[model samples]
Target: MTKNRHFEIFLATSPGLEDMLCAEVKLKGFRQPKAVPGGVTLRGGWPEVWRANLWIRGASRVLARIGQFRAEYLNQLEVRAKEVSWGELLRTDVPFRVEVSCSTSRIYHSGAAAERIAKAITETLGVPRSETADIIVRARIENNFCTLSLDTSGDLLHRRGHKEAVNRAPMRETMASLFLRKCGYNGQEPVLDPMCGSGTFVIEAAEVAARLNPGRSRHFAFEHFATFDPEAWEQMRAVKSQRAPEFHFYGSDRDAGAITMSRANAERAGVTAYTTFNQATVSDILPPAGPPGLVILNAPYGTRIGDKKKLSALYRALGQRMLEHFKGWRVGIITTETSLAHATGLPFLPTGAPIPHGGLKVFLFQTDILK
Candidate 1:
């Protein structure tokens, strides 16, 4: 557990959410968090890497930048790669893989670079290399400088490992958490998703209210490293906060199957006690019996060639319902087009940069407390 030495820890996020991830990292007390292009960078060792994978909600993945060297030739790359302390980093019994990318460099063959690095590691650490291994070493050879980073997160952090059922175009939990933060939600007030697909928004809100760790149910890649301390990792993962929330999160959909999936997903996440799912349409949606809170949704806006005439009606109905029953609540709509958001006729503030969803660019349209 190198308690004294630290490495450059990078927390990856969606393209448009680097600053939000940085803020979350800083609030979690990681040392010197700075927002770079696609993620947040900090300084920490193995324990910090574990905590990052275990705690941060807005991050997509966590990476540990192990070592770097300037090598204009493949022989120099192999020699310097052999100098790295692979014995201290990787386990001899575990399998690993290498992936390399080269740009504007003398040693521009990515496959050759990967081969050299893999040979060096296999010879030095006696670890078997597999093409399908979960543990990976990523190399970026840009401007003739080779930068090495280890993917400490095996699976993407968005997968909380609890939800077995997901609806079409489902929103990821990591992105949902950041969207909630963008809507100024601190988990104090109730959250409702009228068109809740798989209960992602509601379940995430409930977990936040309970102060549950997003990564609690998932396994991280760092757990397989030679330097991993299972006892210390257990202690870190076991810390629970006392700030429990009392309000409930609500979700409703017109499809009975969606409601069923929502309930099951919430149950699997251990938040069913604080969540309520109902089957209803946009016209039938109603606010919960509590203080006015947030009415957020990822309504089904069709693809580029989708029927705009019908989607407009859906947006209008959602807007009408928000105005009728949720007078004091704020609203957030995640959609692909501005025209659909405009059809709602709600007074929206300036929108944020386009966020890359599954394959489409989605925008978050928010409003002030409704009049």
Candidate 2:
């Protein structure tokens, strides 16, 4: 059993994606991480923090819970903030930034409260505060209680620090993982996306199948803290190669440009060696030589283009293709319109939740049997 620690860590994700993120955390071997409103809360120590930064594909960011206190007013907030031992978490040479959010408490102005907390850090620990610091600690208050957290993962962990070439309407990493989870993808079998724009589905599926660390290539803010252990981080990174699988991940896009983008994105993700990218339309979709598994697609949902009628034919054709060719394979489609999904013609059950994708509401449609 991994030794338990007094600390709590949170892995934040976009709203409505919490369940998927929490499931991914558990699948990656973290102990009981509870799904919260915007994130998952896990009980662990610094080693877990390092592991979370190196792994945890679905998290938008990882935060370490440093302190929690009740403050009905600014005077109480300042006094409480000053009492905490900021020196233990910060150093004079290292600069930091603070973000604040408040709800249902006397501390109404989050901006002013954040300023006060930043001032407290500078006054109490002598650490300079700056907007562009490598470290950004956040304080959130609700019902007159404040919880302070340090962002362990920098750059909004969803950035993955990869995907230099992404097309418009590219899916966020957090959303991709959540969608994969909802589609029942476990990285244990073959997965493909015929409309793999930016390779979000394909890349995330490959990452899971190859057992690659999603955050491995990125830098985290926790590294700057004085308490961050280099040895622990190294140990976490050393497991990268041990997790790779022995199979190829497949993805194809109708757009030649999207195919190129997926290949480039997969290359940067270090999973290209295990990925196969092709250029083909849904009509050209074919079964892989391997056993059938999950098939997920995020096609043009007629969202930004403002032409549902034009895309209706496209969606209808896609449904016909899936029904005719993809028998016995689990199929998942994400789209913004119920009528567009109906156009697919394949019998599907609504996943019953709205997920935020590309600033539009997307619902997942799944069909277990092509017939």
Candidate 1: segments with Cα more than 4 A from true spot: 1-3, 304-306
Best by lDDT: 1
Q: What TM-score fits each model?
A: 0.96, 0.94
Q: Cα lDDT for residue 304, model 2?
A: 54
Cα lDDT for residue 282, model 1?
A: 93
For model 2, residues 1-371, the per-residue Cα lDDT tens digits are 12244588998887888888888889878999999998899998878888887888888888988889999988788888887778777768988998999999999999889988888888998998889887887999999999999887878877888878887777787788788888887878778888888898889888888777787777778788877777877766876454666566778877899889999999898888878889998888887887677788776767755489999888888888777777777888888888888898878875676876667888888888565
Q: Give candidate 2 misplaced runs (Cα > 4 Å).
A: 1-5, 241-247
Global lDDT of model 1: 0.90
* Residue range 1-371, candidate 1, lDDT tens digits: 24457889889998999988888888888889999988999998888899889889999999898888899999999999998889888998899999999999999999999999999999898899999999999898999999888899999999998999998889999999989888988889999999898999999889888988889998989889877889999999888873557899999998899999999999999998899999999999888897999988887777743487779988988888888888999999999989999998899999989999988999999999999
In model 2, how large is the Cα lDDT of residue 319? Answer: 81
